[model samples]
Target: MDMERRTLLGLAAGAGMALSVTGARAQTIADGGRAGPADPTEIIRLWPDGTPGGEGVTVTPIVPERSTDPAFHDRYAQYTTDPILTVFRPERPNGSAMLLIPGGGYRWAVLDKEGYDVARVFAASGTTCFVLRYRLPADGWAAGADAPLQDAQRAIRLIRSRAADYGVDPKKIGVLGASAGGHLAGLASARTDAAYAATDAADALSLRPDLTVLMYPVATMADPYVHAGSRTHLLGETPSPERIAAYSLERMDWRGAAPVFLLHALDDASVPVENSLQLLTTLKAAAVPTEVHLFQEGSHGFGIRLIQGRPAQVWPDLVRAWAARLDFPL
Candidate 1:
């Protein structure tokens, strides 16, 4: 009868389709088909062997709430392939690996423009690239606080576990995120909070990234400046004050954080530049290895697109140079 109900009903219907049901009337029925190994709690197979048999890499559809929420499925349907990673070690290869997290306000992952495109550049620069299709927020289930972080941590550990196979230097793994993904990246680099039980062998590997790259990140949990959507989606309607403190990267100690590179636009509108400024200041004050690039003019969520008159487009090159300075094989 009302907007909320309508939205909920629509979401339910979408969820049904995601679960292989035809319409809104029928309940979800398991096909008893086993999908490949992923986070059994989060990801679902939309097109198990890539999309309709077009193979570049195996891509999976990731849902927010145990892979059952229709609203999340509907939003995820808009994204075809997020291309988790691309390795470009042809000859004289290096062992560095990087995970790229795309930004879409925690609603959807902007996989193509941000994830794959950026990965291509980094891969050219001798770093193995992983374009992540991380779980989105807004449907509870540790959304704002832990879900994305878990995805990143798992990805890092997974890469580390397969380092020899992928020809990656296990100790040189890095993470880069854009917009809300940048927030996730920062949290991944900052928080030592463990999400999964240390049952498996991969659990022994640390999730802390060696280096972090933030492109217009939503860096805080405090009000006014914090992206309310990300906060509400992550913490839910009634998050405790302690949870807020826990998620704020600026408030946390920078000693344990990895080397961080922050790129932001001074004239952006959606997310203020102060987010970068505050985090950079804190990193500097704490003597954390940090680099900040404040572009003259560029809006939020630009996703590697070049502006007509601004030097913001040169970020990839700058980032490549920075990566070169890390002393890993290039």
Candidate 2:
């Protein structure tokens, strides 16, 4: 096979063991009772009793799919009525935790490419990774535009509450989000306010991530820089000015926020690079420790897939370097 073909094949091989199976409700990952390379150590249902703001709204069951073509292996799951954390534990953990949030433009969650695939990479660095399968706003969530952020907040608290169980230091937790998911993380980092009403004791735990990493995020909800699909699904077509200001990360109040690391491609056709640029400007103004990398290529979200000649392929390793540079234990 040629280099491109080989790279594609390698990506497919990375996900095959875990992506081949199917399930209805949240369950442990297994492939016909056989061991799988990418199977999560645990699949934790975030809301066991009932999801807040989910009353009267019928939730759709999760449906996962992967393309048959080896040339283009795409793995994703949609209609996530049950929000869960798919845990990927490192063989030799260094007591750090990272919450990986995949992006499907807020329509679905990219399970393998962004979730499982990226988890293994971080896991290799002795960092425990939690791949979050959060609730989508367009899925008729009663929380509307805030539904996704609510789920994000809950996940962080849940992890912090059981920090010992996951073998992670409670204070060393951070978040990594791609595309629209980045938008959610960005908003969450801006303020320590609660996204939903307190339901359990876990809610008392902080939702602020110790560190924030955004990959080609949709940071703005306003014109000239908004990712239309993410905005429409999140805030609807005629969102009020207040709502727009609320979701736009660059325009939000970010004082005392956690340090942010951003990655974006100048040639990205999906989300404008200015989204990160403007956000970078805002973070500096607020005195938030920020680092941004703008690549000439690496078009869009590839999630650790080593494209033959792309500089973005090195992002996976760069995470550990960034953490070390800032004296963040990894």
Candidate 3:
């Protein structure tokens, strides 16, 4: 089954009709509730409110007319819905914060499996977790690569602007993405060659992240090993070879870039293991502090899910440990 949802973009006084599409199966009521780990510090629900009136913070659109495919809800519809982040403020109010980007191949967002679960883990420990419900490329192909990245930057900026209310350390804000989301997370972390332009009050805030967590991330746009879906999304059709190289992780400016934690599985087919390899190499070469972990046998997109006998899904724990090591105040 294919399901599509279209959202109207109201720019100034103009109405822009962008095909905001999603393809995924219908999500059951059970999909809304998470299984493990629950703590209620501060829960904030969001709506489509642009700027004037909304929740404590608003995730404004950086770009208008983003694509949302016809089958967006049918194929991977679960990711399309707006999510209420299960906020976890530290007992003593740690200043560090993280925005979790759940992966769905840019088609769906595994919000519960990756986004909420991971955020809960961090909030329980000592970090504020803001789960990012970013806009995906309408179609599975690279039709809407930049949309997600724009959303990511906007999310960081929003958090930073409201850091005081959220009890988060603006300087300690970090970003985490699973797969395609990981690619966007990396894009937000790295200094891309794409020209930085000011569009709105939101644009005035910096897009750079303080830290990044990439799980099975797509690192390069030019390399064959890099996920083609990711490449197509970032670089549209017939992109010059130079642009392709410029989009690669190795090509970006890593100086003063955020610290990164990368995780991937060796036996994954969706995205090759080499993607993480090249990224870690680039991070290290750039002297950006990073931590690399490669499991022996897990496959792709298995966020917070049990695979082997032990807890292969305990990635949140590792993240908690890593965040503590950063030594940033709450």
- The model with the greatest lDDT is 2
| Candidate 2 segments whose C-alpha is farther than 4 A from its true place | 1-36, 70-73, 306-308
Give the TM-score ranking, best first: 2, 1, 3
lDDT of 3 by residue, 1-330 (tens): 011211111221122121222222112121122233332323332222331111233232221211243321111223233433335565656778888887766655665556765666666667878876665544331324555665677677767877898677778888888888888788888864332334556557777888888998877777578677766655665678887887677677787898888888898898998989988777888999998888887788776643536445666667667767887532
Regions more than 4 Å wrong, model 1: 1-92, 140-144, 306-309
- Candidate 1 C-alpha error for residue 298, in Å: 1.2
**lDDT tens digits, residues 86-144, model 2?**
77878898888988898888888787777777788888878888888888887777888
- For residues 252-312, what per-residue lDDT tens digits would candidate 1 score against the true structure? 8878688888999988787888889888888998887887888888888776544534688
Cα lDDT, all candidates: 0.64, 0.78, 0.62
Consecutive 10-residue window with the lowest summed lDDT within model 1: 37-46
Per-prediction TM-score, please?
0.72, 0.88, 0.71
Candidate 3 local Cα displacement, residue 140, angstroms: 13
